[model samples]
Target: MLRITTLLLILVAISSCSNKKTETEPLTAEHKAKIVGLSKDLIKSINDFDFSIVNSTWSNKAFKDRVSNITGTQKSVFEHIFEKDLKRKIKTGNLSIIHHINSTNGAASFFNLDHKDHHSELTILLTYNDNFNFFKYRIEIENQKPVLSDSYNFRDNLWYSEKIINSLRLASKHNAFSNDRRETNIAIHNSDQELLKGDTLEALYYLYDIPTTHQTGNWLSFRKLTLAQSLSDSVYASVMVTEYENNKSLYMKYLYHLYFSDSTDLEKVYDILSEELGESKTLDSLVSSGSFWD
Candidate 1:
C-alpha cells in the first residue's frame, strides 16, 4: 500500500514536471497524473480490504464485466490467492507512472510501485472509451507473461483467441504422449496407409481424454502415420508442421501445415511462425484441432 504523503509528493513532482514541457495534442503529464491518482486509490482500497471502494472505482471498465463471467471455481481461487494479494497491507515507496500515448487512441499508465522487498510492481492499463464514452474500459495490472502457458482448449465450431486460452492454462495437462500422439494417429488413418494407420475409432475415444488424470494406456496421436497412409494411396496430400528440438529459441520451433503426393514427391505449402510465441495474447487450441499443425 502507498503512504498518503508519498502519493502526494509524487503527484506534486509530476505536476511540476508538466509545467516545464510544451505539449502537443497527445497525452499530457497532467492528464496522466490524474489517472495515476485514481489507480493509486484503487490499490489503496484493495490494500485496506475496502471492497466497496475497489468495486466502485472501476465502474466504467471492461474488467468488471470479465469478472462477472468468472466461474464459481475461478471465484474461489481469487478469494484464495488473488484477493489476498490484492488486499494485503504493505509499505510502498517511490511511485512513478509512465504514460504511453498513441496517435490513434491516446494512452494509458503503468503504476510503478517500489516496495521494501527491493522489488517493484509495474502495472499498465487504461479506461479507454469509444467515441461515445460508453464506459468500455480495461484496467489490468498488465504482465508480459501470465501464470499459465497452455490450457485446456474446448472448441465446438469457432476460432477462440490464443491469448485467452494460453493465459489461463485452465484444467489442462502436458502429456507429451496424448494430444500430439492421438491427432497424428487419426490423420494417418484418414490418409489411408494400412500399415501406418491405427484403429481410428479407438484413437478418437482417447483423443479428448487429455487434461485429465485418467490414464488410458492406449496409442495416441500420429502424423508420420498419417503421411504414410497418404503415401499408400499413391497421393499423399496432407499438412505437415516440423517441431524444433529447442523450442525456447522462439523462432526455431514452428507450427506447419503441408500437403504431399508421395513421401519423396511433395508440395511444400502453407507455413507461418513468429519469433513472438509466448506473448500475453494466446496460443490457440487450433493446434490440437489439426487446424494449422495438420
Candidate 2:
C-alpha cells in the first residue's frame, strides 16, 4: 500500500509538470470572455439590423467617437445600410475564435463568417478597445472566385483588414506570400499611346501604377482593375501579349461593367480608372515581353 501511494504521488507530480509546461498563451479567462461577449454584441447588432442597439451596447464615448467622424448625410446613409440590408446580405455561415499572437492591452478576435448564398466569405476583425469597453470591428470579404484585392474598397466603401491577416493566411493554403512577388507594370509614354506595358512581376501593375491591395489572405493582396473577369485562353495571351496589340478598350469596358454595371453614372471615377489603366498596361506589356517567359 505504501509503494502504491508513492507511485500515485509521482504520477501527480508528473501531471502537474506537464500542465505547467503547456504552451497556451497567458490571458485572463474573464477578460477573454468579455471580449467574446462584445464581439457577439457587435455581430448581433449587425444581424438584427439595429444600429440603436449598438448605441446601447457600446459605450457612449466610443459611439460618439466613431459617429462624430461621419460628417453629414453620409452618416444617415451608412446607418441606414447597417440598420437594414447589411445583415440580410451576408449570413453568418460559420464562426470560430482565433487566438492573438500576444494579448497585451486588449484583445482581437478573428472569425470567418460564411455567406453561402453569395458564395462569399468574410473575415471579421473584432478588436477590443483599450478599456475592453467595446469592439472596433471591420470585416473583409473574399468571394467564391477567390479575389484578394483592395481596388473594390473605392467602390464598395467597406473596409477590409489592416490586422488579422496572419490568422487569415492559416485558413487558406493556396495563399502565396513573398517579397519577390512582382506587380505588373504598365508605363505610358504619351497620354494617347503606350510607351511600354506588361510587367510580369506584379498583377497590380497590370491593374494600376499604385498598388493598393485588399487581403486575399495574409500573403496576397489584389485589386480589381478590370471589374469584369475576361475569359482568357492561352491562344489569346499568345496573340496579344503586348499592350500595343492588346484590346484595351474591350477590357476597360468590361471593368466598367464589373463595378458600375451598365447603368451607373459614376463616370468621373471611371475616367480616372481608365487613364490609370492606360499607363499601367503600357509598362506591363514591356516588362512581360522579355524572353525569360514564353
Candidate 3:
C-alpha cells in the first residue's frame, strides 16, 4: 500500500511538470496577431502625423523620459523632431510594414519607407513586462537603403566583397617576386575608385556576400574585433553592442560597419544630404554622379 502511494505521487508530480512546461511555451498565434495589430496601428499613426495616436502607443513615462533626455525638456517635443527629422522627406503614402517578429520578452516591427526620392527602412522594437505593458520602445531608421544590399541579397554581396578584398591583399603580399605587381596595383586602384563611386551602404553590403566556409567564421570574427578596436566612441560601441544583443543578424552587423565608416548618426547624415540636395529631389542624381564616400 505504501509503495503504491509513493508511485502515484511521483506520477502526479511528473504530469504537473509537463503541464507547466506546455503552459510556459513561446508565443502562440493569438499573441502574434496582437503584436501585428499594435505595429500596424503605430504605422498608421505615423502616416497621419497624429501625435495623439503616437502618444497612446508609447508608455507615457518612457516616452517622456526619452524626449526629455534628447531635447533637454520634460515637455512633449517629439512632434517637432518627427516633422523636421523624420517626416520632412518621408512619403507617408509609401510607408508600409514589411515584417514583425515576437520574442519571449518583446516584439519588433520592420518597415519599408519609400520616400519622395529615396528609399529607407525603419525598425521599431518594444519590450514589455510579464503583464504585457510595454515599458520601452525604440525606432531606428536606415536612410538610403542600398538597392542590392537589402536583406535578401546582403549575404551574397558580402561574400563577393570579401573575395575581392582578400585577393587584393594576397597580391600585395606576393608582389615582391611577381613581375605583374603593376597590374595588381592597377587592379587595387580601380577597385578603390569603384568603391568611391558607389553607395557606401552598397560597399558594406559586399561583406555579406562572402561564402560560408570554415575560414569565413574566423574572418568575420576578426573583422568584428578590428572594428571594435577602431571605434573611439564608447557610447556608440555600447549602442551597437545592445543592438547586436537584441538582433543577432548579419544585416545588423553590416549596418554597424556603415555607421563606423560614416562616423555620423544615420538620421543626421540623411538630414544633411536632404538639405544640400533638396528634399523634393531624388538621390539618384547624387548616387549616380559619384560615390558619396569619396
Q: Which candidate is the best by lDDT?
A: 3
TM-score-better candidate, 1 vs 2: 2
Ranking of all predicted structures according to TM-score, beginning with the best and ending with the worst: 2, 1, 3
- In order of listing, the candidates' clash counts read 19, 31, 13
Report the candidate with higher TM-score, 2 versus 3: 2
- Local distance difference test values of all predictions, in order: 0.30, 0.31, 0.36
Cα lDDT tens digits for candidate 1, 33-121: 44455556644543344445333433222221233334444334434543454223211101111111222343343333222121122
Least accurate 10 contiguous residues by lDDT in model 3: 144-153
- The residue ranges of model 1 lying beyond 4 angstroms of the native Cα positions read 1-26, 59-294
Q: What is the lDDT of residue 11 in candidate 1?
A: 75
Residue 106 CA displacement from its true place in model 1, Å: 35
Question: Model 2 residue 40 lDDT?
Answer: 61
lDDT of 3 by residue, 186-286 (tens): 44455445468853333333433332321222344434434444444673476466454544444455456555765444335444534532342333333
Q: What lDDT does model 2 reach?
A: 0.31
